[model samples]
Target: MVSPFEAGMFSGPWRSLLSLREDVHVEETAEGDLVLHGRWGDVLLRQPDPVVRGVLNRMSLGPISLSNAVSGHGGGAHGAAAVLRVLDRIEPLVVRTVGRSDGRLLVSVAPIAPAARLRPEPLPADRPIRLSRFAMVRTDGSGYILESPLSLHRATLHHPGAVRMIGMLARATTTAEALGDPPDDRLLVDALVLLTAAGLVVRGEHAAAPAEKATFAEDTDPALAAWSPLDLMFHTRSTLGRHDHDFGATYPLGTGRSPEPVVRPAADGPVIALDRPAWEEILGVDPPLSVAVEGRRTARRYTGEPVSLRELGELLYRTARVRSLVLRQDGEEPSASSRPYPSGGSSYELEIYMTTTGGRDLPGGVYHYDPLGHRLEVVSTDPAIVAELLENARTAADASGTAAVLLTMTARFRRVSWKYRGPAYALMLKNLGALTQTLYLVATAMGLSASPLGAGDVDTSARALGVDWRVESSLGELLIGRPGTSSGDTGRLPVNDAAWAERAAAYLGVKRGG
Candidate 1:
């Protein structure tokens, strides 16, 4: 008995319908329509009313497996590693087919790549069974079933008019050549999405494993946390707390000095020059005077001059100021929020710290900037705090000198965990990057300098700041000063001095040289 699809192939205007590819010419015949005259099966487009179906003029595919790709160490022996091991042993394969204008049938064969290795184990008998393959004899009849060696997770039918499509794809000699039939990019993509989602097919491409980077959470210590404190005194001055403080119990100074050396003012600052003709040419088309987007050119060197307190205030305000109120309707009440920078959930978990040397009417002490009121709060007028801040930043980074370091601490995961559950770490890092970029742009516009530091000592820094261990701290150091010649730069540390700092902590018999 002819199937509904096979009957429809001959009875309907399947001949006039379009071929997915513009190059392929569609022809009618006693057997049906011809799409491609391949070595194996002939490809045909069968009209089944609403949805046109791509059917294999001949063939059937055997059992297939539905499984996730294994990656990394595979966790444990019984996890991904075990699964891939089993798949390697079975070595299941698929078959393909083609049709001709003369009703001639051709079939081909190919092997699936080793994307995964599975471990052999008896599947639970009571567990639900998974079907790997099925064939449609007709549009409405019970299709022929092909048992899958591995259970199928789920199944989806594309068009009731086409059953041979799955078999054609499964058995194809070359997956890419078969997919090349339908040239419509969007349609092809949609079809692929559907098949993959239903666990009916696998793509040829493979994805890379996730990245691994060192983080504060990986550190082993009692006082250490992801976040630490930022005081500018020692950072701006190139010295650790070589003094005493009443804040907490100080550990014996270690022999090793902080690896982080303070970044000194550039002697012959970065030189930036622009091509006048190129600048004018682009500007002539759509001149933007309000905001200039300059090309990547060396900026002119600066003669060191103390940045005024007013200028610092403006920089903070422009970059980290709360512009306007963001209101959203809550369950029963309306919530109004504010932020210095745009936030994913308005968590505003970032805290800003400032370390300065010289400014009119402001002493060279570390200060915390308050975004809410657009003001600076004095954390401690003591110069020793700056040393403490720099020590923390250097310890966290295990590197050298950075001027004007900003410390950001995460007080509570609950701040955003409720809205963005398990992925809070990713979101937090993104927020940090944004905050750094905002500061960088503001510094650029103000003719100052800034740098973002990824490494720092969170444990010691947190202890100094009197913050809880759970709070995560990060060092974002910015060096701001008048650019000048190398000879005249006072902030420039001698190479020997810089080297000495690295070993100072160990020499002092404590974590920091101070």
Candidate 2:
């Protein structure tokens, strides 16, 4: 449907000028007379006639009739003929009868011409301007939205004049001159300046590159090449510090829309009960938090020693166990449970799966960690799938030693998307970072080797676990095992390891040599 602003520009006076035929020809002859060949037949406009010259100059402002021009001078046959000749010089001219004005017949005359070129100087009152191809314009209920994707600039125009200006530009390229006198000259000029600065509008002869071709020419990532307008719009709008949207409301948990069960139940698979140790028992005789922080480093190489089932259980319990479930019935929002790690909106969305390569008292397979029950639910018994998962971890770490355990972290998107608008994926990423740090600290305190993987194959993990990629997708992976006695380098040491070690030792109150 056409908007009111659009109807005014397209159905009003501007429409007559834009709808003219393009084939009509106009040219200057050797005698300096302007010759036009159109539907009305050939005619010649003599430049020497003063009235004809005035009419031609007025045509630059828009279409004008010879009768109007000659009536002001003197209504004579000879002067009318001269004015008609000048009108014919503009190809594809049209004449229509209208209401009588001042007891004289009024004729509306329109002449079609090529769109005017954008000019660099202040727009002339007679010329028209248009939006460049790179400019994207749309209107919502509130106001008009203008965006230049190439320049990465956006503007929201709510003022009536500004909206009308954009509508005129869309209907046909027109200048401020063609718009006539403005209600507020300062406001009009300021709006135009801002639009010009944002690359939203162009005047004179300048032509901008098309948005699609320009975007493809500059974008480097192949994954992003497949993005659609909706994809980009969703990504930008949902992220923080952009346009405003509904936020901070504790949306009620609708009937049957409660969060997914905290833990997935194992139907018939073998459940390996996990031994949970108290925090006090685990911290006994261990290094202080400062020492643990100082000693924490990404371990790329393991000792080729098998990690015990008890150690795996301890790691999961410390980093991701569900501590308690809170239920509120005091007329406030619905209740939510709490976990060891922080989550956005108390929406603990992360779930853990593990692949073990025949660890002590543990079989080699893929299993899901039931955080609520503190047990492992067997997902797959295929050794090849287990091997592939461990291989991916080793490749990600670039280490020769095999990883005893590979932790795959996946997020339940609906948990956060239910309450949040745009920052759902961002919140998941933040949750992953917090979970990784928790793993790092827990591993450090337990004297186990741990390294976060930089990359993982999502499809491979999904196939091995028989989980739907759309429902839950892998976000991160971490390799955990016993620490090696030797240097156990993966040939990927930090460039400034010596300097870092010295600084770390000083901060931890230990001598460098010691």
lDDT of 1 by residue, 1-514 (tens): 2211111122221111101111223344555533443222344534321111111111111211111112132233344333333223222211221222333222111222222111212222121211122311222243322211121212223232224445444432222333343322222323333333223343222221211121121133343333232222222112212211112212123323212111111223222121112335333432122221121111223333556666677666656655555544544322334555665556555666665543455676656665555666665556676666655544444333434434444333334444443345456666767776666554544445443446555675465444565644543454444333323325866764544433422232231111
Per-residue alpha-carbon lDDT of candidate 2 for residues 132-248, written as tens digits (9 for 90 to 100): 445666777755666643333455564565667666665334344335455234335435544553446655443223311222222355655776645565565555333333444
How many angstroms is residue 388 displaced in model 2 relative to the true structure, after the best TM-score fit?
1.5
Best by TM-score, which number?
Answer: 2
The C-alpha local distance difference test score for the whole of candidate 1 amounts to: 0.36
lDDT of 2 at 398: 85
Worst 10 residues of 2 by lDDT: 111-120
Q: TM-score for model 1?
A: 0.37
* For model 1, the run of ten residues with the poorest summed lDDT: 13-22
Q: Which stretches of candidate 1 lie over 4 Å from their true place?
A: 1-117, 121-305, 327-340, 391-412, 485-514
